[model samples]
Structures are given as structure tokens and as C-alpha cells.
Target: MRIPESFFVIYQPKYTVPCVFDLNERGTFPNHPSVTGTWGFRVLADTDLKASVQFAHLVHRPGKDPQTGKAYEWMVEETSIDLDDQLTLDSAAVEKKITDSEIRSALMDAFNEWHDNFVPMKKKKVDIEELKQKLGNVVDECKERIRKELVRKNQHWVSSNIPRRIHDFKYGLYNHVKERLYQEYQSNGGEDSEPNLLKKIALFNRVLDNFDHEDLMKPDGTVWRNEDEIWQCWIGFAGSEDEAYRICRTMDAVFKDLELDEVG
Candidate 1:
């Protein structure tokens, strides 16, 4: 008896119609592309099979008959296999054979063998190098902003009377950027590589630059402090200090550099 269609899973290539595989009494299966593409099917369950099997590939020639005006399928490839010669299958043996590296690799090889025969070739090529350069530029810009707008501001914390206030501003900015990077990493297949880190840094920097007092106020006239509000004092503060402190940080090296620049 033929294996039930439900017992097989077709590993059809993306953007291609499924190739039909139908078994007959003689163990011969003739396959043709729906339009013209390739696919491989795998048997998920063990079943009784014929002693011999033959596979044939058919192609639908593009041009139509001048008189009949109908396309025709032409047999282009053929192969065969004898199951009895290959093995006597027990559950363990079948599982081992299917999982074997050679067999697994062959499955992918067969799937990729099919290609578009009818379509004309005129696909636009992507400039991968150009895209890479642009991405590098954006990351570099983010790094520059981090140094100038964020790290450089550490000078204020060095001399300020209220040290903890400035410390939270620095700490808050660190957490904010870190949180942004973590979120981006989770969405990006968990790769915390330098490039991805830089991208997220650039993104959070923009978020900080756009912070506003009007967006953070509550109905009771108190400033709402959550992820959005990076610093304290939503009402009395009338300058960019709060926003800068919450969004950026100062380091010892940056503070030293600021003093030197001032002396010069």
C-alpha cells in the first residue's frame, strides 16, 4: 500500500509551490513543479514499502504549441532505489540512519537542486558594502555623541555639592542605555556584539535628547518619575541640566580632560 500523504512532510523551498509526489503500484513516482520549482519530502513514520522505487522529474516547457496553444511536461531526470538492499529497518536502526550526517546532508542537497527554469534573469543586486558603510557611519556618530554629550558632562559631578543627585543622573543614564541595549539584543537573536551595542547606544542617546517636562507631569501637579523621567525636579528646573544628567554620564577621565581643556 502507498504511504499515506499525511505520513510525509514536504520540505518545500521558500517562495516555491510544493512539488507533488504520488506513488503508484509499480513504485514509480513522477514529480513535476507546480509552476517550476523543487522540493524534498521526508517520511516521518515507518511503513511497509515496495522492494524497489523509481523517481522521475518532469518539466513543463515554457513555449506553447503554435496550433494547440498548450504547454507540455517533459521528463528530464530519473533515478531509482532498492530499499531491501539498503537495510532491514528496526526502530533504532531507522532512527540512526535518518539522523546520520550523510543522510541529513543529502536531504538538503536534494531540496536545493531545483531552480527556476522558465523565468528570465534580471534581478537587481544589492550593494552590501554600501549598506555596511552606512551602518558604520551611524554607529560612529552615536559613539561621538556619547563622548561629547554624555561622558564630557562628568565635570559637573566632580565639583557639585549634591554629589548623589549627579550620581543618580549618571547611574540613570547608564541603566537607560543598558536597558535599551538589552531590549535590542533580545530582539536581535541575543547577539551582544559591539556593533549592536553601538546601535542601541545611538538609539538611547536620541531618546534622551528628546526628553521633555510636559510629557512627564501628573494630574496632581507632581512630576511622574518612571523610565521616562531620568532626573528629579520636573517643575522648578528650567534648563537642559536635568535632561542631560539623566541621559548622559561623567567619567573620571572625562572630568580630567575637561579641566585640562579649561586650563588651555
Candidate 2:
């Protein structure tokens, strides 16, 4: 058979293992001298960095083991076979077919030799339960630190920019009023103060009737002068853990609804 071009697993255990072989783009297995020069076949395994024996490439086959009466898959050493025509031969013409038992024994022998040499130095498998508890503690600590830092940063930003924002807002409001006053002054013959004033009042009243004041109202029922004020108010309101959780839940629900729509 022609050797596969992709990385193939020779053996795999029930748990995670480090991959040993790193394949370069030139199609050479640098880790194994036996298969270093051979091209076409690529093998990769996950093994401990300290140990030479790494196991990776999980292959799931159907059916239970006849001997153990439990479903199991073959885990063996990965080897690259040469793609040269000299290595390719018809088994029928050769008059000897390797049985499954023989193949298993050969692979097991190779695995055992490699394991014996390097397994003594390999670190013990990590206790997942203990690690999970430690992870939870770390996450809680991280959340608290992040919350505090965000609050400090936001307060600093608001303090530094509040004066500038207030000044800009005042200037904008003054300009709007000034433009209306100028328009009324010109339309009312420039010299008639009473007519200009009356016209300005009527124009402002019409503006109040047509404009949506609620557009400037924040969620907390306070009016905002500018977009920065609105953003600052929103950040302050939603900075709590509960608000974050609610937002996440809402986003998750929206995504799920979109997925269901796609499926339908």
C-alpha cells in the first residue's frame, strides 16, 4: 500500500498524550532516524516533552474485542513506509499475509521497548479533579481583579474627560440657539425685537413638538448631553456581574434562535 501523505496515528490511549513527531514542510521525519529520509508518510504523536514516547492519533474502530469483551482500538508506534515502488508488493503474490495478531505483536514489542527506555522519567498524569478545583479558584480571582481594574480605569476616563465633554455640549447647545435667533432676526426685519422674539418662541415650540426627546434619555431615566455621556452612563449601569450575566444569556439565546431558524 502507498503510504498516506497526512499524519496518521500509530497508537492511542484513552487519555490525552503529547504528540512527539514534528513534521517539517519538506516531508521528512526529523525525530526518527529510521524514517527521516522516507518521503510520503507522515506520523505524529502527542507525547510528554521530557519523554521520547508520545501517543496520539486516536482511531475508533467498530465492535468489541473478542478477548476482553470490551470495545477497544489499536494503539501502536507510528512508522512511515517508503512510497517507492520497491516497498510496494502484492501480498497474494508474496504467499505470506501478515495476520492481525502478528501485526499487533510486532507493534506492541516496539512500543514496549520505547516505553521502557523513557517512561521512568515521564511525569505522572495530572489529577483532573484537583486541577479543576484550582481552575475554579483562579477564575474567581481573575473576575474580581478584572472588575476592580475596569472600575478604576473607567473612573479615571470619566474624571479626565467630563470637563471637556460638558464644555463641548454647552457650545453645541449655544450654537443651536444662536442659529435660530439669527434666522428669526433676519426674517423679522432685523430691527423689530418683539417680532424676532415671538417668531423664535414659536419656532422653538414647533421644534419641541416634532423632536423625540426620549432619544436622549438613558436607561436610568436621565437625559444625556452627548454620545460620550450616554456611553459612560451605560458602562456604569452594566458594569455589575449580574448585568454581564444577563447580557451573555441574552446573546446566547439570540444565537440559539438564529441556529434554529437556520435548521428550520
Q: Candidate 1's residue-wise lDDT over 1-264, tens digit each?
A: 133331222112353343434322232223343433332333221123222222333434444445555554433333333333221123333334345455446543543352122112344533445534433444444334433443234324222323443445446644444445444444534444544334333434333332455465432333333432333221112123333343233222333454576699
TM-score of each: 0.18, 0.19
Cα deviation in Å at residue 9, candidate 2? 34
lDDT of 2 by residue, 193-259 (tens): 4433333333222222213555765333444444433332333334544443333343344445556
- Kindly report which residue pairs in candidate 1 clash with one another: 154-250
For model 1, the run of ten residues with the poorest summed lDDT: 230-239
Model 1 sits at a Cα RMSD from the real structure of 23.5
